[model samples]
Target chain A: MPSEFTSTLNSSTLEAGQTQLKIDGLQLNFGGVAALYNISLEVKQSEILAIIGPNGAGKTSLLNCISGLYHPQRGKITYFNSSEHEMTHMKPHQIAQLGVARSFQNIELFRHMTVLDNLLSGCHIHMKTDLFSSMLYWGKAQREHIQFRRFVEDIIDLLEIEAIRYQTVGSLSYGLQKRVEMGRALAMRPSLLLLDEPMAGMNSEEKEDMARFVLDINEEHGVTIVLIEHDMGVVMDISDRIAVLNFGQKIGEGTPDEVRRNPVVIEAYLGEEHSPYPLRSKL
Target chain B: MISGIFHSTYEQDMALRHTHAQKIRLAILIVFLLVFPFLANRYYLTLANQIGIAVIGAIGLNILVGYTGQISLGQGGFMAVGAYTAGILTARMGMPWWASTLVACFVTAGVGAAFGLPSLRLKGLYLAIATLAAQEIILWVVTHWKAVTGGVDALVVPNPELFGIRMNTDFNFYWLVWALVILVTFASVNLFRTRFGRAFIAIRDQDIAASVMGVDLFKYKLLAFAISSFWVGLAGALTAHYRSIVTWERFTIDVSVLYLAMIIIGGLGKITGSYLGAIFMTLLPAVLSNLGRVVKGVFPGVEGIIPFIQQATFGLVIILFLILEPEGLNKIWKNIKDYFRLWPFSY
Candidate 1:
């Protein structure tokens, strides 16, 4: 088997609105600089959770930590799946095999490959045939590939990227590229999807389209979403719960309604009179 | 639109040949391959045989370089492993040629995997240099290992026989060479249609992203190296038996560079590209000599410069293609196909 993530997972642990991932005392450092400090957070199953903060607030670093890109020096990240696997020490692919998929802050679509190919590449885990079976490309391998192609087609349709499915990702516009990245991540059939600044560098209409897709991915597909967005209006509108970070520390985390009134989040964004790090926002 | 081509079912969409023209093209190709040996002279057959051998090695190289995006300069060294293995088994161990060839494949795969171990830490140019080091190391070992390898001397390969028929001639060996070439090429073409192929491309494009999508980097990288060298080893065994000699000198670093050149000119990431590149690169010197002969009558004094000019032309051609159309001959073939697919109608 191609290690398709689903077959190995415990199905019962995928219930929406339950605590899916838990991070405790997470700390990351780059020499003298601390990227994340004493960060404790919980992502509930199926809910849209947004991590919002100023630039250098460790929002991306948190996603990187969960995705196993950047290993934290201290902490425990537990993926509450059918089986409990410690995320903190696992390799990136191992964490990914746990049904955890992510998109990059900057779009990382395979520039040379077509949109369809990029999505199919995401189906690496599902198509588990040996070199012999694959080289023959008959019966089981063919069936599995067609099955996954159908699944990827749904993502292409959902994201409305059918027009450019055969086009190379390099030729796609920024908005379409981001959508393709989301589509690629979704092709893994993830239990938890980490989207890093998906709406960055987009017009309002593009942002609106992305917001709908994020909502659809959560509600329709029942996938848990952890979003990082700087557009406060979109974040406030879409996120069920929000976590605020500043200088690698968790300042506040609550429902968007609750987070909007938090003094710490406000102070982090619009700084105190003498603080030089005033963040630009529409919150 | 490609006229009269419509797929109502997923099975049709997943087919290797979906269109009537593609099936027809394949039929034509098969027919041509079958008939070529009869029409060509011994010299042309020799050239064709070289293409067949180079095609096998080039396809293997493509798997490592183009698909998996791992640059290996030790391909020649891996081939030497196959050549020596074939030489030892058929000559020393008294094994059959068929058995020796099969054994060489597995043995070479093992050696390639050992060399590929450093790939986890090294990448790009570093990996290339490491593989180069492996080439030098393998050559050194082959040169020094007197008992096992006969040490820097040529070992005569026994004639390959099928059902008590000793096939000693290049014409006789042409059947074995082309059969394996076609088989390996078929496998290579089909490989990309499956998940492993996609995984290789994914790794090539972005190893980090490929890993995050749940591809085991270590497994696939080693598999690429192993499988690639496995075929190259098969080619080596064939070469040893065909020439009726095995010496480590033939499988030099120069052969590896030539194989790289074949894939580059054929185009990266396409199976058909390997065929084009291999045939073109293998026959390029012959074509150049023919051109040089014609130019000799026009300029009598420049006979010594022909080899220099040929080398320069190869470099110039590669540079021009790299600058003008980096995708190579396969892309040109694709463009021509596209034109015909929409014949009498502009897109």
Candidate 2:
């Protein structure tokens, strides 16, 4: 496993992970209530896979299960970086070490750490493991850090957060904090990135900026991203494929056009009584 | 004229010192530290030595509680391990101060890691309680163990000799204590510039988020414990040699509270704050005691009231500081420096 991971890591450009993220028969529970039940979907590699659902539709829960945050009682989540790997049973850090990075629904930026420091933390797996490196940081640690900092600086430039790069994350406005959050996840240089409502509590301008960043990260970096979002219009615009969930079960899964026209998907978004036309028009 | 540093590269941008003014200020500070021993009397030198020991131990505690966000009141316990180990090695087995201190550091770190093992299973107030339990256990062991520690009796430490030069005098010891203080401070300041320090901060902020970012929560938490204990242990070994004795009572729960107070009053997470907080806290008691003596002499009928007044003053100072500047002395220092940098236009 280590050799295979190293082989994939040594390559300068990402030239792999071109298989589907197959989530089959995923079941999670909190006490007795089911969070997700019998959920299955496939996210094609290098595509923006957006999971859309109502408030309690288990969108974030599915992402949690996929990213190995929540261990489900039943089901398997499989991904391919260069070869098939089981992620459902892995620890969150182990999954992340395999180049799967994620951001939280609520901003989880290290509030005390500076923006630069938070992003530096995103490269945790890439750094040397010895505590001595940090104790005497002028040698190997400093060299490796300056190298990663250059990469983080590029990300800062890309996210348009350079002016506030040295500021504490807690001091930033909500919109700016969200941008930094995305930048931190991107700093991992992950082959697969997961975002949970990247644009939550954002103004129109902030939402547009976040959307563009998502698009750029996908197109330019060629990173396979799975995002959980509520904004139907934004989800419809960027998603190469859409998976809709309702009450712990997947109701519909397809491309934007296919999911948009599907009766089940429309019904899930609206109600059984309401017509799907108004929702489609809103999108 | 150059108004500020113009960083030409990313490394320069992240360098610890960005300006000539900072370099100049640091230089002056270094000179002052070097010259301090000659200027001060023996009493003041001993007080300075106390501050030096407190500074190192406080930095260690700061790393665990401040940077890693793990609350630990077992600092004195770890320090006891170091002090006892150093005492046994140097006084009993006839080892050198440097070698014994180094060995004591590793021993204390191991004990500290053992206690920190439960940190992964506990957090916040629970973790604090667990470490508090560790402190109690360590203290119990140190008190009961007789032959090695001399039990309740003092285990005398011979004067540390570097190249056969005796360091019993406060003037000589001053150089050694302050020098270790400098090295520890330097290493700690550099710690945050690298990934390990950043990861610790991340774990402190949000463990789940840090895990998703690829930081091993278990490893970093334990590492935080070990690293912090190493510093406290080193301080312990130094104190053993400096005081020329090791006793179990010297490392009681009160010492742990004092160390925590140093970190809190200095600043929770900042290195400079820890140093300043140590200085401020270590001297505050002495200053209060002197003030109390003056009050007692003036009032004539307040023999029992002086200690109470000292206690009240300590609590009052902490409360006032927490209310006015909760960020600690580091924030105050930063504000002062910023104001000076902005000059006449300062807001």
Candidate 3:
């Protein structure tokens, strides 16, 4: 079923194993409190780089800075698509136009619109018909609208959301809404996809489905992904590399196996298992 | 299940009128509109003209408030801009009616976009107040800018010459006005079907998500305002030409509230609501006055308070619609259609 969808994915313009995004000494503060402190990270092309951290570790904040939702007080975030694009100060829409798309931690599908319309909106930047042409609803406007509708239908098929394509997004279940959000992001034809806890609240079966979709998006779509996840099992299973943040700093960064073995990573999680305040006793 | 509706192609699926029944109904409507002038008397013709003008204005307001979810109290002010612009161009500067109306639309759209600047940082009730301020400011300019607006006295608008024929009678203006009403309605429907319309709705639904999904929030918000005001400005220009006068009193804060009531009662976010709302609101006063005349004939002493009763009834009806049917006339119309759609077999 998924083999046919290979044609739907844009042929990757990027060379394999190239640096896709580089974040340098990122500093973000809300008033006097620092959210992200000197976070430097690298995302290679078509890799699933999961950022795992405890609460308030600035994992989501890092993703937000890279996606242009938050401007870091000091740091440079550069995206490498066809060229090196300085994305530190770009607007969200401008960054999106350059093939960067993000799904919110909470599903942000247009509540009033149908599933299809929300996905169709993902094709907004690609569409070129002006107001007058749209008003006439013929020639360019009709062609573009139908073409994008076809594109959105392909995404709907890939996500296996055909049944709820016409359903209002607000009426959908949590898992379905999350899938729809991913489908909407995919509809943008993004080269870099930022997902904040894509499987935050879901059953094991739903979590497995989401993990599979995330892998499919990264591998099959040839898109670089920066994911923030709390589930250690899924993170270890699917992530190509893992970056761990604790207390607004990157505590450990390596391959999933390496990170799992690192004492620092284990301490951040289990917290000095044999020591006096072994994280469990503190909690 | 909806039976006998099938589409083999995307074009068919994306068509404005989907089913054969809808197309048939559209044909029937076109026939009715074409035959209306001949059947109706002069008084009804004038009334129809008024409804047509209101329909144009209400649809414009609905685009901003209903579809785009931007509450605006500047509809009346924008209309005044259109009316005054057209009045000055045609009556003061000797420009042709059509040309002046065209300029009026663009001018009003510019003003609307300018006022919409505050919307980028504002939301909901705060944004509504900002637009209300726009209404008051534009009205003040129109009233105090005496040399251009012709002081406190009403500016006289020339009867427009359409295709070399003087459009002085309600019979002549009715066709022109209704034709525009149809054109603007078609345009509004088309606007929503495309990406531009989707952008407007996206901003309304979720601004942050929309921006991240590549919708330029500031550009689209201003565009919504400009497009909305263009339709409204056209309505105002037509009103000026139809009535052969332009006055500050006609485009007051109360008039802005009245337009808001039209969209609220018509159903927000639906084009059908705009048409139904405009017709219902325009006809409401006329119906109440006729009822007033009948009551006066019966009592002979109730004439003095009839105006007050009319005002009170209009306010009460708006409140009733808000509380009882917030979705407006469009929902009721849909309910009627749905009930009959499945007939006796319906659950």
Candidate 4:
């Protein structure tokens, strides 16, 4: 089954020149304890890949490495954009500039700024107007500001966040704030979107809404998404392929059906005695 | 429709207006600035000069505390460095007044950066302590360095001349000071929209997040320090040249505290607040002095009570402003204008 998953992933690998992200021999350690061991992954153009793991399974660590928040001890993360440049060891903002954007596990919206301003800040890198032009409120600055505002307004509308557009993020509900964070990331107009626990701590309805939003973003926008989530049901339901990590090691990688029947994954999740889900329920 | 055009979030609403209304207002302000020297009598001209000097210093302090969110209790020190540098160059080296002023601003900015070095390692209370130490050290140096600073004795700065016009009259000096204040204020306002200005605000909001977002903290912080000191130094140079006198007593820790008070009483991080604060503080003493003269005529014992009452009132006002209206007089002005703007329908 693992071999079959590998073959599928291999087939998906960037037709020689179109891969969005490639990770090889990734490893991370906190002092003496290894947090990630030789984890490797690939995200091709416009693919939705899910990483599922239990608590302390090095899921966030991998995402951090990809986002340039943490440097992996031994790894090569090569990301190729449409510009024919492969980015390696770039800074977080530099990586962001190369069309990779991320939302945090805990939302990191600029709380002091209004929701509109937060979205506007995400477009800071894209703004063409200089400081002098902005200060003077010149023709170029006004035009550029209007353009960016239109773009941001479209995203806000798409996210269904128009009512609270002028409200501060600090005053928003947690679920709304999370959506705003997604909007902010989307404002960057990233080709590859990394959502860290996109549906974490949400109720069933909120999770369903978020799942629909993610699906719409992926299918309609054709954005390649790499997400870290704990909900196995959501992962199994949406992901084309899933990677399971246990104790800082990749225990299984396969389709949902293949992973469900794997004995090692069952043991890792339910322990030896309670391995079979149907049998345990009956007992 | 007017309010609709101006309607925005707190961030936008607080923005310095550059609209047609503001342009007309600015033109009127320019006219007022041009005519102020001729209209005011000698005492009023002297008062205007003091306001100009204070405004210059306040603008620099506002940049440090308001834009950068770095507490500096050492603006007085930077001012002293500028004053003494100008004083020594002109009085001893026979440097022209203008040349000395320019040299003084640069030298003092360099010294301000030296004082700003500890800010890289220290912040908040620790940063304030570093500045306080700078203030004390600078004052001690100016007092003890008899050769250059002339100790505590007043160093007579020569009467300045510009284009062969001797600035002997208060009106002439008033124009010079007013021009300097306006130029400095304009530059300071423009600085807010720059890369350095954004970085300063970023650091103020969240240093770690700012760094992660590609802002180089060290470079920007140091730049903020340098720019802040440069302005303060310029103010000092103007004061030294305008006064034609320099003494150690001029740049004491008290003056540093007073400058801090000005920024606080005006409003933190607002350019308009600085000007408002300077005018407010500079006029308070004159108002009290006039009141004192009236009371002296009415009550024989009121003469001794005036200084004590003034000092107590100053302290009480600062405390009141901090506790009751920490946003300072700027907010008050905004409220009044907003009330008028909204008129019958208050929001």
TM-score of chain A of each: 0.91, 0.89, 0.93, 0.88
DockQ of 1: 0.74
Give the per-residue lDDT of model 4 (tens digit) for B1-347: 15555445433433467366667878998899888777778899998889888998998888888877789999888999999998889888889888998898888878988888888789998999999999999999999988878898999988888888987468888877887887787677756643446556657765544544445567667777777887788889888888889988889989999999999999888888998999999999899889889989999988988999999888998999999999999999888877866678877
Question: Can you tell me which runs of candidate 2 are displaced by over 4 Å?
Answer: A1-17, A271-283, B1-5
Prediction RMSDs, each to the true structure: 3.2, 3.4, 2.4, 6.8
Docking class of 3: high
Report the error of model 2 at residue A206, Å: 1.8
| Per-candidate interface DockQ score | 0.74, 0.76, 0.84, 0.18
Per-residue lDDT over A138-159 for candidate 2, one digit per residue giving the tens place of the 0 to 100 score: 6667777777777677778888
DockQ, candidate 4, comes to: 0.18
Q: For residue B295, give model 4's deviation from the true position in Å.
A: 3.9
| Alpha carbon lDDT of each predicted model | 0.87, 0.85, 0.89, 0.78
lDDT of 4 by residue, A197-267 (tens): 99998998888888888887777667788898888788878877678888889898877878778777876
Model 4: docking quality category:
incorrect
> lDDT tens string, model 1, B1-347?
65555678877766778888899999998899889888989999899898998999889989999899999899899889988899899999999999999999999999999999999889999999999998899889988999989888888888888888776576777788999998998898888877788888888988888889998899989999998999989988888888889898898998888888888889987888999999889888899999999999999998989999999998888888788878988988999999989988977
Evaluate residue A58 in candidate 3 and report its C-alpha lDDT on the 0 to 100 scale. 90
Relative to the true interface, what fraction of contacts does candidate 3 keep?
0.88
TM-score of chain A of 1: 0.91
Writing each residue's lDDT as its tens digit, candidate 1 over A173-277 gives: 999999999989988878899999999999999999999999888777678899999999999999999999999999999998788788777777634435454
- Give the distance in Å from residue B155's predicted Cα in candidate 1 to where it truly belongs: 1.4
Q: Specify the highest-lDDT model's number.
A: 3
Check candidate 4 and list the clashing pairs.
B66-B269
**Span of ten consecutive residues with least summed lDDT in model 1 chain B:** B1-10
- Candidate 1 regions off by >4 Å? A1-12, A270-283, B1-5, B294-299
